[model samples]
Target: MTDPHLDLAARAGVADERALLSAFADNYRAIFRAKVAGLSEADARRSPVRTGTSIGGLLKHLRWMEQAWFQRVLADEPNLPDRPAGEFFPTNEDTVESLLAEYDAQCEISRRIAAAHELSDTGVHHNLGEVTLRWIYVHVIEETARHAGQADIIREQLDGVTGPEI
Candidate 1:
């Protein structure tokens, strides 16, 4: 099957604003996912850098980001559980496979949520206050792309593998 993420780039020239933003967001998400694939759980949890950011942790954090923005902020789903304090690091209970599955699931949910809303639709954030769906799309794209770059570095440090291919 053709990779949908790869296909996005080909169609970007003609994509509307929402589709363009979604394309960028999905591409970065795919890159982040690719960075974690084929790694052992042990390797994924290993922090090569001094900051202690492992591939597993990044995956988990990205999953939380998806839920936070799409479900909590946008959809305003009630009584969502709180995230762990500070930066998220994976627990022993979090396996690489499980993290990947969770991240993918959350991404799918995010996509559906975005699709249901208009770009002009507004959401009230606790601190940001009254942000548009277009703003959220831009925010997610930047955040995911930044984290994906970090993941690329970590992956390269782990095994010299690079690029966004999966």
Candidate 2:
């Protein structure tokens, strides 16, 4: 689904902190969603990349990231369950449906967190000290988009699917 938030941010310009932050959050989700487009559950799990990127792993990372920033850092929620050993690596076992469901749920949580906080809301990063909600949003957008670019390459190599084209 297209995110109107990102569109709104685009119109508002990145120089505006609130609009930039919102757009960043929206863009992160859009990038993740687009990476899995037209792929079956099994296909998304396939490790098409020689490096480490996988659609499933990417989704998992997105989940980890959102929870880390919003729920854990911002809201001070209890620690999430630790990831299993070697979970970051690419694997064939992940199903597209399961991954997609997880992604959607994480995105929903992110939306709620964003809505509940003002743009100036602050949180302590585990390593970076205090930061504004706007910073988290921008960071996530850039980080996720970077991975999405990788996903685009991997998907193309796997099935000749070019991003923004098909």
Candidate 3:
């Protein structure tokens, strides 16, 4: 059967670091989403490992991570509300569809916000003080890539699926 989540967006030309961020981040995001395609709510909530990171929780966490870097830090919007996450399971409102939709929406906002800043543009981070837009992009790419691998493993635990369709 065709997996809709694996249908990744086409990469734009990587003429600069910004384009590179979009391509790599978007690729992993798509692959990560595909990792949990058609998972039951219970299965999505399962945390087989001691770290207590479930596939559904990873989706929620990734969305939150994107907002933390791109929207709150890079865009310098400190007033954005924070979301509390569970150790492994998502909150009651976090269904598979809702999480995916929110993540995609955040991606759109990230694209728009990222284009407005220069690589050297600076923002105040809560923990790290001042940081550059370049730093945020690099941080996000690494964070997303790590979670993508985690999602791949968790998805395999949920079902027998291994290796991303993307």
Candidate 4:
């Protein structure tokens, strides 16, 4: 499928806050989404890197992080159901389609929250004390980008495919 996010990210360059934010989000999105491209249902879930960081698991982790930071923390919604981190972890039951669906849901929820708030809006974090919505966005962007980098390395190690060049 065509990921509008990729296009969106492409439009965002490393300039100002808006562009920077979009760039961060885009890198994160690209890392996970790109890793699964051209892989089978089985290969996508395989921890071929031996680090338990399967492409599926990475997608689930990003989803969990978005919900945790944006929805659960910022909006103060109740924690995401009984889903332990394990649900997102790759097991024999995880499929490429299922992981992508979960990621899409997370992306929708996150985009809604992000659209409604400014980066300056503040929320009380139990650990970090008061944090601005801007911080969360950047934090997620940075964190996601880092993981995406990891995914790039892992994907290459698994199959010889690598880099943004595709």
Candidate 5:
């Protein structure tokens, strides 16, 4: 039941483009966190879809999403770390708290990257040729919000929770 660190109101005073983009992405990320709050690790691993979109898996995927976009796409890091097997699924070692902590930390790293560069700063995307930090922000917002919606549905299936609640 930890209150999400980045308050939605943090965007209120941020006039810079980078901070604004980070605020939007972080807001959605927090909403995703709120949806699965208080669930046990086992409960978090419950999947309601044939695609195996469990809350834990969604969190793991999101953490990877942030890292992949920022480290790989934005920074253009050459040697990427090996992603573990079932990177999207919840392994025995993966906990709700652990995934959430990684999400929070990854969000922080994203914010720092945005702060350091302009919206026009371009980097090499793995699939796409190149994209700006602006595009990355918008893309993260879309992707994070999409997964947050899924988390909402899965949470409702588990305990009648319906909204992001943040």
Candidate 6:
């Protein structure tokens, strides 16, 4: 049987920096999404941790992050919706399926935006000033991986599921 987990080493072996970073970013995205798979709506919205970081909330936050970096920052689209007041907590209308679908759509938009620019191309960040596509890729990878690990722990707490597999 084929091994299901992403092979980071294989991804790292790619010579192109863009490809390598995109691979890692996409891998962590998949891992985070898998962590929330098969969870009931109640479980997905449960805040087991003190900080109240639910799986659904993570999905929503990450979806916004993708739009912030790729659409607003890179694509120069200034009219994106503001983040909800709860930030990491999903609203009552946000089901797990809807959150996941929105996340997937945002990720696709991110990929398209990234593909249009070279790694060295720069975008003006709201706080950081000018930033390169390379920096964005690395930042997103770190952010996604960090949250993915958090999701892993939360999923394990919820149903004893561990790792990135669905």
Among these predicted structures, which one has the highest TM-score?
1
- Residue-by-residue lDDT tens digits, candidate 1, 40-158: 98888888999999888888898999888988889998998887664369887889888898899999999999999999998888999988889999999888888888888888899
Which residue segments of model 6 deviate by more than 4 Å? 1-5, 8-12
Model 5, stretches more than 4 Å misplaced?
1-16
CA lDDT, candidate 2, residue 84: 54
Report how far off residue 72 is in candidate 3 (Å): 1.1
Model 6 clash pairs?
Answer: none
Candidate 4 Cα lDDT to native:
0.73
lDDT (10s digit) by residue, model 4, range 1-166: 6555665565665577856685667656765677667767666777766567776777777878888788877777874664464854776766778777777788778878877888788777779988888888888888777777777877787788875632
Superposed model 3: Cα runs more than 4 Å off: 1-14, 85-88
Residue 38 displacement in candidate 2 (angstroms): 1.8
Q: Between which residue pairs do clashes occur in model 2? A: 41-96
Q: After superposition, how far is residue 96 of candidate 4 from its true place, in Å?
A: 0.9
What lDDT does model 6 reach?
0.85
TM-score to true structure, per model: 0.93, 0.81, 0.85, 0.82, 0.87, 0.92
Candidate 3, poorest ten consecutive residues by summed lDDT: 3-12
In model 1, where do residues sit more than 4 Å from their true spots? none
How much is 155 displaced in model 3, in angstroms? 1.1
Ranking by lDDT: 6, 1, 5, 3, 4, 2
Clashes of each: 0, 1, 0, 1, 0, 0
RMSD from true fold, candidate 1: 1.9
Alpha-carbon shift of residue 10 in model 2 (angstroms): 3.4
Look at candidate 3 and tell me the lDDT of residue 93: 79
Cα error, candidate 1, residue 40 (Å): 0.9
Estimate every model's Cα lDDT from 0 to 1: 0.85, 0.71, 0.77, 0.73, 0.81, 0.85
